[model samples]
Target: YYQEEFAIRRTLISCLDWCDILRIWDVDALL
Candidate 1:
């Protein structure tokens, strides 16, 4: 159970990180 929760949390964090990276790229492209 604990391992499953940890995996979910890690996946969520990576998804958020990817979003942030994409946002930054979008801003850079606009500039």
Candidate 2:
């Protein structure tokens, strides 16, 4: 259970990081 929880947290953080990066890219494209 602990391992699974840790994996999920890592995945969530990674996904959030990707989202931030994509948002930056999208803004750059618009400008």
**Number of backbone-clashing residue pairs for each candidate, in the order shown:** 0, 0
lDDT of 2 by residue, 1-31 (tens): 9999999999999999999999999999999
Clashing pairs in 1: none
Q: How far does residue 13 in candidate 1 sit from its true spot (Å)?
A: 0.1
TM-score of each: 0.96, 0.92
In candidate 2, residue 12 scores what lDDT? 100
Alpha-carbon runs more than 4 Å astray in model 2: none
Model 1 segments more than 4 A misplaced: none
For each candidate, C-alpha RMSD in Å? 0.3, 0.4
